[model samples]
Target: MEKSVSKKAEQTLKKARVKYPIGVKLVVIITVLLLVSLGTITFLVSAMVSSDVRITAEDNNFTVNRRSATEAENKLNTVRSNVFLLLDMLNAAGSSAALSRQASAFFFERNQDIAAVVIPGSLELVNTRFFVSNEIETTLITLFLQNEAAAVRRAVAGEPLLINAAPVFGVPVIAMLYPWQESGYEQAVVTFFSSEDLTESFGSGANSSFMVNDQGDVLVHADYNLVRAGANMANTPIVQAMQESGDRNLQLLYTDQEGNRFFSAFRKISIGDAAVITSIEYNIVFEGIAATTRRNIFLTAAVLFAAILFIWFFSKTISSPVRVLAAAAGQIEQGNFEINLKAKTQDELGLLTDSFVNMSRGLAERERLKDTFGRFINKDIAEKAMKGELTLGGETKHVTIFFSDIRSFTAISEKLEPHEIVGFLNDYMTRMVRCVNDTNGVVDKFIGDAVMAVWGAPISAGSPMADALNCVRSALMMRAALLEFNEGRGGEKKPIIKIGCGINTGDVVAGQIGSSERMEYTVIGDAVNLASRTEALNKPLGTDILITENTYNLIKDYLIVEEMPSVTVKGKEKPVRMFAVVNIPDANDIPGAGAKGPRTLAEVRNLLGIKAPDMNKVDTDAEEQKYKIQES
Candidate 1:
């Protein structure tokens, strides 16, 4: 039952461990910490990189936009200055068609950006449309210029307009008119310059450039389709913001109508109310940083996996030994001192395992010593001997000596095989020896089918009287034990057996007695011889337990006895008294026997199936050798 409960507790401990293994906890704890630390570091790095890259990208966009704007403005400025030079030369050569033709040719030569030049008729200048191409080019330019006749009127009305887009010409064009003051007549020259040159300077990429007028109308853009479609960007957030902003150039991040975010930089030029603008999608601007963040995530995951694997193996190295030690502890708890364990490492766990092994060995040795000596000596005496506290030489002790022999043992042995004889002795002696040991008697030796034991030798029950009482109690106990041993034993190999116990109390020499190589603990003197002789007399006397007067005197009050006829010792003239023990009165003799113990000699004789002895017909020579019985 104790083993079962221990097994249940171990199972409970196993169930509790299902979720809380040291290896798993180590992996989880370390993984979480790695995740937190790596995640925070990745976030911080990405944030910092994004911030720096965004600023750098914005600055780059602004720088490129401003340069493009300046290039376009300078081109337009050259056209304005060359047109003014032509007007001055024509004014100097008044009324000369040759000079007028020469001036127009000179202006067109200095600026090939000019597709056509228009001179409105006035007091000093002719309404001349100078075309530089064949009929096809002339017709195409003429057709596109006619659409801007309204802008000419606006220039004549002193508004002085610059229309930066004229995709009507099938290419990028800039048409501008400055108020002309010539000979006090209201007239103007409209020069058509190719802004296509600016398109060559632009690049199409994630970052793109385009020009827009004050009205936010796109012109000279890298995408010629927007110019062709006349796409108006007037409501564009960045363009509107640029228009409102007092700065000449600025960078901003804004979302378009499609919810697409953009990084945009705008620069206003000095000509034609035009501005150069560049923009890139926000995701494209930070794609590199996004890639870096993903790599950081993957790296952190890899490190976590590696660390978990390492911790698992490492924790197993530690916890496995602990598990083995726990199992060893259970084995020890069950009284199995022999253990199989080894220290596989040189760390603290290995040290603990080594210590456990030593402790188990010590216990096994102690148990072996108890087994070797305890059958022939008291356990306390064996312990004292192991600790070097027992005296090796003889000492006189007032002790009770007990001897019991099986009756008709030679006849019983002849009826059984040799193995059966051993088994029979072992079975019978086991019960009888328990009776002796239970009452603090040490078995001194076994002589064939007999047993010798001593009380109050080497160790005592405080006094001779105490030891004597214990010896007598053991004799009664053996009677009951032998009765148990004989039940259902009628077979040849397992014949019914009876034993007689003789107990005597006297001063005897007791100690370890033998040669240096072979030692035995025993008692000697007249008491032991008398006890042996008294045991042999049991068959003739019809008794199972007999005690000398010396033993009977110390335990008279505790036992019921019948005084037997005197027996004269072999060498003594006087006779020694003997008694037949029937019961121990209140000794708790057997289960359901009376509280006063078995009270009558008749009851004992009946229990043991002992027939009455006829001393008149009993004259044994073996008994005569030991004593002379004087029958009453």
Candidate 2:
């Protein structure tokens, strides 16, 4: 027993040749596939999110810069308009004394951030309060004169010009002025406001605002030192980007002289030579991005951890049972039929485990009975009987019966030893049974060296014509099987094997027969008898296969057959016609050659010169009434 089990184990190992078990492989493969899928999705999502964040940040920078610049421009324009309105009001007053009174009133009423209004070419005080001394006005006039050429040129071109850090009472001020040609003189109303005014108008949280001249000179800036000192930042990437851009607006990333990177949006306002610039430190702008990235990383890590846990749990839940089943199957493979699996769940895997347990019991029982019943009946039929497909009852069904017998089997058996006879019979029966089963015919029984098979009973091939054709095919295959069997026995001094087959199609009773304790599934009635009688005629007709008129009619179009004599049998008064099946020709053999009645047969015979026997004389009435019983 131990040797037997060891040999079975060796056979299983040789068949599978696997290095590792299925559970580990399943877990590894599933984990790898899932990780690859999720990893790809995460990468793509991260890339898209990062791109959108950058785009949104840049767009927001543009919006903020443009808005702040517009606000600053509006403030400057209001101050210049007030100064111009005062000048016009003084001109309307028609006297220097009335102009002085109007200027005094306007200066007192206006914002304190506006220092004084002056005419550029003549250095005339267009508007001033009592607080503005002659010396302070004179100093402002001198600064305006120093930069008068550039400012006047811009003013003459119908543009507002702003001068950064003009001296007024030794204090830095932003000077914005407009020019008009009055009395052939280029006169202008210039407003001087502190840099504090510009800073207050454009200040923002997390960002800085500044104005730069065309020479990249820091004009109005929150840092008073840069404004007072007139710092030059001409080499800055932000200024260079603006100068290179044709749209007069630019958003860029720049690093300052201190090597601090920043994101900057700059717009050259139409009001002056100055461009309004808004800047946020790179750290400030990327703070949100960093926070989002950290959140995403944490989320991705959490998801990956959860996925790992799920994969572990899934592997345990699914592979544990599968591994158990595999181990149990290995035991069964080693010839140990005792297997009991506890399937607690109702899933497919649990059902598979339950099936394995039942199969082990079934295999054990089959092992105990295979030698006894399997020799009498086919293993397939014996198993079906055990499965309750065969029972002690019968039903009349349309069936095609097949019968095949070895030619001169008794003489051949007499020449061989008992063991040799068994071997020869096993080989012959195995091949012939394969042919019958392959063609969907059920082997009813074995009668010595003969086989009885039927189609269309119990499980029909769907139709009578199909069953009939299958019966003829099975008969032909059995003859071919015998020829092949003979070829394999080339070196032996044994007789070459030959088989004769016959088939008939009709209604027959098919089911279990004999005693209740030892029943056998079979077919009975006249159809089965006719099949046997036709098989016996094969020896006299010198043919391998013959079919009764009923089967011949069903398969005549597919097969090349010759008509034989119509013989009266003991069963009925009618003579039964039989045909010898030579071979199936082709798919397009004879058209409409098998459709009932005399017309098809007449056309077949007339076209193919098929010889039909004369249906001449009748035997005695007593001989017809002999009451010959057919086998059941």
Candidate 3:
């Protein structure tokens, strides 16, 4: 009997050893899956966050750039308008063959604005005089005639002109002149522009502003030091391209003498026989944007990192029960069915694990079922459903959809290697999403560098237009942030990230859209399409933020509106009227008038030249000829 008992005990021990191996294998599988899932989730979250940061920086940079360009254009336009007005006065006064010298004298004496009037006949300045009776006129005449004959000829042949000539005492003289042809007198209206006007028109900052002639000669620059040093900006890419292409709105990014990268936008201003090239550095215009972006990014990153740490700790605490269950299962598999899993907490996982212990009578079968359930349904999903996100159907709601696609993402991708491209996209997308999220917009998906988002759905306050406006404002803010990021990158590879945002307010089918196997909470409707098309239209319209007519109609009262021409969208019969959100007017300003000034010289010339002169003859031809010959 003792011998039989010994043999049974030995057999039981052998069976226990086999069961222990199986239990150990199951535990290892669970542990590995947990680590991998955690690692993958962490990596994905980190990658997503990092991408968001980069995109936010890029978008911010682009928006700020756009704003800076607009502001510069507006300011220059204002100055140009003033110049045009002066030209008109000159043109009107100069058109009289009888009053040519009298008009010059009137321009010099009556108007404190006009500094001097230099009338050039063919190639040489026949009459050069200033408002002040000073020695500067002799030096200015000499400088104007020196190597400027070709320019004068071009100006005489119906080309308006502006020339920058350095005079004595290092004063830069900007010559604004146009061809003047009447019955008796055939000449050009040459007006010497005051340096003070140039400085006031183009504000002083790190970024310098200049006006160049069609020949690429620096006609008028804010930087007197550079002008005095004989810097020939005419040969620069900015001037060369303008002369070559005659593109009125020319933009170029180049490194300066100090190796600092600068973005310049050039506009060709033709007075009559001369072209004025206006160029301003982008850096000075968007300096505030750069500072704002840096501050926001640093703050956001700090908060996000802290939140991630909190999430990791919270996840560990929540997952502690699963870890315990895994250990218990390993023990039970070693033929230790006598073990008690006393974690009788009300949580579904704990209850399930407790049930598993009680069903140890058929442990292998129970284990098989548990394994199958774990594989078919992710443990997290199962637990979450039990706690509730698996409710069937979501409510219909009004949502504002925003879609943004980079203008030349495909070209950018082609330029970069596959890995670099991926990195770039990742960085760009991440920041864009973050900006949306920061502004209470939910990111729905990413199609390469494009981002789709929605407001007033999932989580909203019923103000779809307001939400959309917030999103756009945030996007603009993000552009300023990116400049600092680029600065850190040695200012190379300045990312030209342009975004178009369209916001439409309408009801949509909002719910989890997918099979039970895979699902995403999203919205779908015509409004989505409208929003997408609005964003796409940004490039064509030369705008950064664009909103649908519906959206504009809703927010017109609160937000300033600039009615854009109707545009034909992809699936629409009639074109849509989009409105751009202008910067909020100052408290002390009128809605349409922040700053007002005189019309430009070009405009003045256009107004005067619109009606050709019916000149009456004067006997001053002989006197003028005598004066011209004497001056020559």
Candidate 4:
């Protein structure tokens, strides 16, 4: 028994010579896919959030700068217009000096930011001027006239000069003066007021606002100390951008001198040489987004870690069962069919493990039976039985039946020794059986030197038409295989042989026949009987193959055949038509061959060394009475 098992093992290994290289497993593939999916999602979300925050910051900067600039310009315009109104009131000549004094007091009351307003007399009184403030009018006017000499000269020379800042006043002061000469005398009005309110309503909270002169001097700023110091901001990015830009307003991102980045905006203001600048730090702008991104990254990392761990453990559940099954299969290969596997979970892996256990037990029983009875069953029947698919009784099937016999087996057997005859029959049966198996037909049995086969019963080759085609194809294959088998043969021990095949297509009952203890899988019906009778006619007709009317009808277009006289069977009243097989046109798709056979019966008889029967002898009635041949 051990020797038998070992020999079987060696045979199985020899048959399983083909091997393929292993590839990457599911765990790694799934892990890589998961990482890519999470990473892509995280990156896209972070990018969108960052973009939105940056845009919002820029918009805020632009809005703050524009609003603040408008407020400052409105304030300055109000102050300048009020000063002009005072000049106009003073220039009204029909009014008395008392009226002019009263009008100046009213102007000073209405324009409280005006520090002191000076109105020059007409050309007759060039040295004479009216004062809007009684207390500091003379001192402030003298200081501004002395400190800003160029400005004073410009105002007197008929040029309206506006000075936003006068350092001599030691306050936020806006000084404006204009020429008022009706006669050609050097006379003008000068007024000074605080610029404190210009920026009072601008900068607050995270956004800071400031104004820079064309020279880049910090004129009005949220920081009072910077304004007082007259900070030079010529090199600042916002200041430089404002000076260079042709736009009325602009916004961008920049890093300040301190290397702190900000979202900043610049707006050109109406105030002399000044523009409003608003800025908010980049960190403050996108801090929320940054924080969110950090959280997302952390979460993604956690999810990735968890997914990897899960995939690792999950793959174990599958691979472990597979490994156990593989080990069990190795034992089975060594003829040890006993298996012990306990499925732990309720997943597919568990189901597979359970199925494997059942399969091992079933294989063990089959092994025991085989040891008792030997390799005793047909291959097809054994396979179906092992798979628990075989059942007793029979089924009605549309099938193609085939029968083949050696031309002169009895006379050859008489000449040869018993052992030699057995050897010869075995060789011939092996080749013929291969043709049947190759065409997917089941060999029903071998009787003496004759073989019977069936297609479309154990399993149909799709339909009756297909079975008929395969049946004819198998006969053609036998023709080729026989010629090859007889390549170098002759004399008594190795006689050159000829075979005749008959095919018929019709309904039959096909199944495992006889009692369960001693059974055979075969087909039985009139189709099988007709096929046997047809094969017997081949020798007398000088044909190598023949088919009944039923099969000829099925594959008439595919085969090149000649019609023969109809035959009268024992039971049938009608004469059944028969045809002699010649050649199948281009039978490609058959393994190792095609319709490379005799195209004419003369060639077939010549190849097989058979003389054609003389049809003019007139023995049709006698042939019918003796061999069931009839001319229709």
Candidate 5:
């Protein structure tokens, strides 16, 4: 016995080994490692290439800065020439007595105007004028002091003057006189140029450019700092470098005291002898290059890091199937059936994957049994039966009962084969069952090609009228569907099928009512019998669907009907009034189609024109009571 047990254990081990070979395990490991290695190498190479590009961009930015500085200086020189020409006009007039007087009158003719004059040492106003009553008045000007020197002075004997000053109040004033008498007025005109205006014409090209005097004071910056105080380029690196080497063209990477780095280039502008240093920041030249490079580097690094991490994480997950399976089994044991395992290998890990397979098969088998039982019985009934609630004893409850049958099933069946007849019966029963279900009706069973359906028991149809109308509508819709069905099967040759639906809404006993060994669910009462009788009456009346007066009155609001004269229905002593349901009208019609018999109850009475004793004359409650009394 001990030897047999040992042999069995060895045999089981051998079978498992055969299913999951050693070679397959090696292959999985090698493949996973190779993928990880390739991913890591690719990430590192991309990062290195991006870093090199960043370095190249930094160098290019330095070169661009130098070129922009030179351009700014040239623009300033052009502006200087224009200003000088305006000043020369004043000087030429000062050289001639006639021209000078004409110049003074020109200023005096305008109100509050000062005659601008260029003398040997200064630019002055000879005659200041003022305005009064829309007339130029040289006498009314109280503040006309003439012969004032301008604020600007030439840096060298031959250098032109540069100045910008506005008049005070309405009095025009000019100062900053350059000595142009020795070189004629034409030479004096060349002295008046603006460095500030010159810098503005750079056309969105550079950030800013400024000139600094040798005294380390700001002579003129760009338009950005014209009104600002304490603006100068003297203390800037461009000036310091120029003073040190006297190199007009110089490049240096200078970081401001505020930590803003700049690639600066310096060039000296010489007017005769004095020099003005020009400086420009590199970012002003390159604009968005460095910032874009830095952004790209950061973005590339972030993407590479995320990619590597993802690859490593995915590789580790793929390598550990046993761990995943163990986790899944734990969840399944705890009743969490949503766990899924992805098989990545055909090795032992994949071969040992039968727990989920077995669990799924067991669950599927249980579900199939539950659904199959639910079809035979009501879903609630099947559930209750499964829980052992369906006992043999009967329980009675109030229900509305209905019964229906194909009007001529025997004649219809004779024309078709046995299989075809079965198909027809199934098709007819299915439509009837669907109708019953739609009205919250429960189908008890099929008695041959007939159906017994009930409402207001397992679930209530809300009102008796609604229950009756539901059965009527179902019969109408079934008849419509049967026409289509017959058309498909060669209508006339297939024996056109018709249905008779009878509905009676009243109180009845409904529950499981059969022997203990074989139980059945059904309703039993006088109302049930009346409903069956009404269905039989359909044949005699030549109607497809019929309902008792009690059923019609309950759902009179939702059914179109034609009345049949009072007729004696077997069990009842008094004659019963019946209606043949035609169609239910749409809500948008002139009159709702469901308005029984006609648009109004009067129309129904008029159309039937019956002279028999009115239904209201007989007490239905009394007749029902009499039937109960006789049954007891």
Candidate 6:
């Protein structure tokens, strides 16, 4: 299933590719790449800017909240000083009236914001005149009496105690104890100040300031409802950041339960184990950064648009010439070698265009010459010649020469018109040449009614035995090919054809052997002459294929042949043994497959339609061990 989907996608892409011209495709590809690169850069820059803006805002908020907390601490210290002074007066006078007057002066006149002044352990409040509500006065008096030991411990330790026990029935205030121990009396001078004093220390804006006790309960809040409800914020992000930050101050960005983002700072108030928290909504805090980012995105988009436009035009300049060259190449592939392209500029693309034109012209000329050369020589040889390997020279090398001629060609031509004779000859020669060419034999030339080929001069079959066997195989296939050709002719009007092939393996001087202006690559040696003679002798021997004794020796183990009468033709002083090949039997089908012994050649004569010769007169014993044939 995956493979099918992938293949379908590939096909769709291929179709889409075909719909666009090279220039358009190039422009699209270049533009897309540029856009991706610029987009990535912009995104990274925006992210970095946003991060820096957040960090800077957090630091400023931390500073602001810290200052406010310090101010609140200073106010609490001032209240402590006033209470200490009142305690000194009470210890000096040791009278209830003096204590009452001192408390009244301190709470009502000296510091009107002081909510209450209490003398703990005396079970009497020194003064509650400043208490706006009776419940506040009663709550403070009760709390001080119950926690007298804690206040005394603070006095002994020289540290003031701050309690946010309750702001006296919803009236927020900070209470502090000044322990008094004068030899016999042990009491704490408790002072209460309104919580609004601390909350008002932080100036108002989009931000809200609040105070939370050690238990995370709201002690004083700009939002009064929170103070009334005593909301716990220990699990809030601001409190979590405060706990995690080992320092007394922390600033961080957090999101609330409603998913509104905020930037908050927390500072431990100097008066007690309370923290002052300032929180501002994220949108308000990062308004300027958001505006800047918007402008940056607009600028980035404009730059990217300009870049893509430039890339598109630039790519067109490059791909335009390439498109023309590609079209010219397509024409060339279809054999239309006439290309007319002009260079438009003096750049690499222009140079490439010029080079392509020259190359195409050169190829067209080469192809013309190649076709003409192929008509005179083999196609493979023509190719090698064009590559400069077919130089004017000669070299002596061992080769297997093959010669095949139609028997009774004159009689056959007399039976048809000149055109029919030409057609018939062409058809015959075409088939014969194919056999030779397929077996790696180079067809050297064609006589009036025969073809001469060789296997080891221009190129070799890599070994002498291979060349000889290839020559024999080509001969056998040519005979089989004739039967196929006759079968294709509808049988009635087709002229029956018979060809005789002769093969010989020997050394020959092979190379170009004519004037420089008109040279022909041909062989001139006794072997070439002998192979022709052997072909002629095929008529007298009544055989379709005959090989000299030397060729026979090389292919004896692979072919089944019968010895023929040894003959001495022109230019040879001794008779050369020849053989008529009958068939190539599968070695596994032959009896005594691995045995090495001399076998009489007559054993295969019946299969080849040749009469057995008298064995005693033929020197059959001399044909054993390894066969050798002289020039004939």
Best by lDDT: 1
Q: What is the C-alpha lDDT profile of model 2 across 1-632, one tens digit per residue?
A: 99999999999656544345455666786777567656755775566566676677778878878887887778777777777776676667656786668675666466666766666654355335423642355455566557666776666666777777543344557777677666677666566765666776566576777888777887777777777776777788888887777877888887888999988999888766678898888777677767766766776677777767877876686778889999998998998888878975545566677778989998887777865777777666777776777888898999998888888888888888888888888988999888888878888878889988889876778899888887776765665566567664633347776667888889888888888887777889988888887787665545667788998778777777777666555666777787877655442222222332123334433333334433233222435433222221
Ranking by TM-score: 4, 2, 1, 6, 5, 3
Ranking by lDDT: 1, 4, 6, 2, 3, 5
lDDT of 5 by residue, 291-366 (tens): 5556656666665576567666755644577677778777767756655665565556555565465575566566
- Write model 3 residue lDDT over 1-632, tens digit each, in one string: 99999999999655434222434544665565555555555554444454454344444444443444345334434444553454556557655755555554554454444454456543222223443433454555656655677766766686766666554324655666566665566566565545555544443444345655556665455666765665667667666766787555556666766766555556555342223333344454445555655655665566556656755675563478778777777777785555566644444554556567767646755456555754443333344444566555677787778787876767666666778778777776666666675677777777767778777766675577676566655544444343333444522243544455566667788776788777766688877877876776555445556677777766666555566666555556666677654433221132221123112323322322222222232122333321110111
lDDT of 6 by residue, 1-632 (tens): 99999999999665444233545656676677667766766675666567777777777777778777777767777877776776666666666786656555654577777766666546344335555444444555575446556655664455656666453446666667655666776556667667776666664766677777665777777766666665778899888777667788877778999999988988886555677888878997779877767776777787778777877787787778889989999999998788999978655676677778989999899899999989989887788878978778889989999998887778777767888878888888888898898889999999989899999878888899988988887886776687676665633246666677888989999988888788888887999888988887665566778899988888799887777778766667778888987655543322222133114444433323345433444332233412223322
The residue pairs in collision within model 1 are 585-596
TM-score to true structure, per model: 0.46, 0.48, 0.32, 0.55, 0.42, 0.45
- Kindly indicate the candidate among 1 and 5 with the higher TM-score: 1
Residue runs of model 1 more than 4 Å from their true location after superposition: 1-334, 339-353, 369-381, 592-597, 620-623
Q: Each candidate's lDDT (Cα)?
A: 0.77, 0.71, 0.56, 0.75, 0.55, 0.72
The 10-residue segment with the lowest total lDDT in model 2: 589-598
> Which residues of candidate 3, in runs, are more than 4 Å off?
1-387, 390-394, 482-495, 584-632
Local lDDT at 495 for model 4: 84
Clashes of each: 1, 0, 32, 0, 11, 0
**TM-score of predicted model 1?**
0.46
Number of the top candidate by TM-score? 4
Candidate 2 local lDDT, residue 51: 64
Model 6 Cα RMSD, Å? 15.2
lDDT minimum window of 10 residues, candidate 4: 123-132
| Model 4, span 1-632: residue lDDT tens | 99999999999666444332112345466667677757766675756667777777788778888888888778767877887776677778445888877777787667777777665433211112223332234465566667767766767787765564535555666566666664456677676766677657665778888877677877677777776666788898888988999998888888987999988898886645568888999999978877777777777777777777877876685677788889989999999888788977555566567778889998899878755543344566667766667667888999999999998788889999988888888888888988888888888888889999988978778988888999999998898788888889988778888888988988999887889787778889988888888887787787888999999999999888888878776667788888988778778665323456566777767876778886555355544543456644
Flag the better candidate by TM-score, 3 or 6: 6
